[model samples]
Target: MKKTTLLLAGLLLVSQLGMAEMKKDVKFTEKTYGVCSREMSVEVVDGKIASFSAVRGCPGNLNALSKLLPGMEVERVIDLLDDNYCSGAPLAGYTSCMDNLVEMLKYHVMGEGEGHIQEIRKNQKAGRKVVAFNGHICSGCGLCNAQLS
Candidate 1:
C-alpha cells in the first residue's frame, strides 16, 4: 500500500511537470485559404484557447465559434476542428475556416504541420503565385461568389 501511494504521487508530479512545459500566453495569426475568412488569430493561455477571431467569414458561425472555443484545451480544439469542411466545393478544397484554425493551431502552437505553412509563406514571400486549390489562385476568383450565390 505504501509503495502504491508513492508511485501514484510520483506519476502525478510527472504529469504536472509535463503540463507545465506546454505552450502558453502566445498569440498566433494565419492567413486562410479557400475560405471566406481572410485571416484568423488565436490567443492561447496556459495551454488553452483564451480567444479566437477571424477577419471575415460567416458572421453567425464565426461568432459562435469565437464564443465557444475559448477556455478549450489547444489539443482538444485541434481534435474538434480537424478535417472540418464547408460548402463541399472543389475550389474551397473541401475545407472550412474552422479547419484553417486547426491548421494554425497545429503549426503555431503544437509545432505540427509547419512544413506546409512554411512553404506557403515562402512562396508568398517570393511573389510566386500560390495556388490554394486545384491549380487555382484564390485572388479575384469567382468560386467563392458561386458558393455564396
Candidate 2:
C-alpha cells in the first residue's frame, strides 16, 4: 500500500506540466516547525547570479523566477533569503520554514491587530507593489522604524 501511494504521488508529480525538465541550481529548504515549502534559483548573467525568487511549491515558476532575477550575486541572494526562506533541504523537510512563516504572520496579526497586512493587500489590489518582511510591510510606515524607548 505504501509503495502504491508513493508511486501514485510520483506519477501525479510527473503529470504536472513543466516539471519533467531538470531544473538547474534549484534549491529547496524546509524548517522543522511547519510545512512551508520554498524553492529558489539564482539567475546568472555575465558569470554572476543576477536575481532570486522565493516561491512556495517545489518546482514553482522556475522559468519566470530565473528571468526575474537576472543579475543577483549568488551568495548575497542566498544570504538575504536565509533569514526568511531558509537554506537548502528536501521537499519533505520544510516544516521549519512553514513554522517560521506562520509564527511571523501570527505575531504581526497579534501585535498590530487583525488585518495588519490589510494595507499591503489594499495596495496590491490597487496595482501597487508591496514589499513585506516578516508579515509586515515596510512601507516607511514609521511603525517599525519608530524609536522604542
Candidate 3:
C-alpha cells in the first residue's frame, strides 16, 4: 500500500513537469521545397498553428489547407497527414503540399532536437505519466476490447 501511494504521487509530479516543459515560446519558420509549393512560412503560437502560406502550388488545394491550418495543433496536423501522397493525380512521385508544410513545421519550427513524441519519451525516462489513462467497458460492448486486442 505504501509503495503504490508513493508511485502514484511520483506519477502526478511527473505529469505536472511534462506539462511545464511543453510551454515553449512562439516562433515562425520558413523553408523552400523541391516540389509543388516552392516555399512556405509557418507561424506557431502556444503549440498551435497561428497561420501558414505557400508559394507556387495548387491554388485551390493550397489555399484550402492554409485556411484550415489555423487554430489546429501542429502535432495533430503532423499525425494526420505526414507522408500522405497525391492519389490518382498526374504529378508522379508527388506528395501533398500540406504534408510538406507539416514536415517543415515539425523539423524547422518544432526544432530537430526534440519532437512531440520524443519529448514524451524523454519525460517518461525521467518518470513522467506517459500513459495517463486506461478504459474498460462495464457492459462489455466489445469495441474497446477489440481495439485493445
Q: Candidate 1's residue-wise lDDT over 70-102, tens digit each?
A: 999998998888877676433243457877787
Clashes of each: 0, 16, 0
Best by lDDT: 1
Instruction: Using TM-score, rank the candidates from best to worst.
Output: 1, 3, 2
Runs in model 2 lying further than 4 Å from the true structure: 1-47, 50-64, 85-149
TM-score of 1: 0.62
lDDT of 3: 0.56
**For residue 78, what is the lDDT in candidate 1?**
83
Task: Please provide, for model 3 over 123-144, each residue's C-alpha lDDT reduced to its tens digit, 9 standing for 90 to 100.
Answer: 3345422221235322222133
Clashes of 3: 0
Model 2 scores a TM of 0.23
Better of 2 and 3 by TM-score: 3
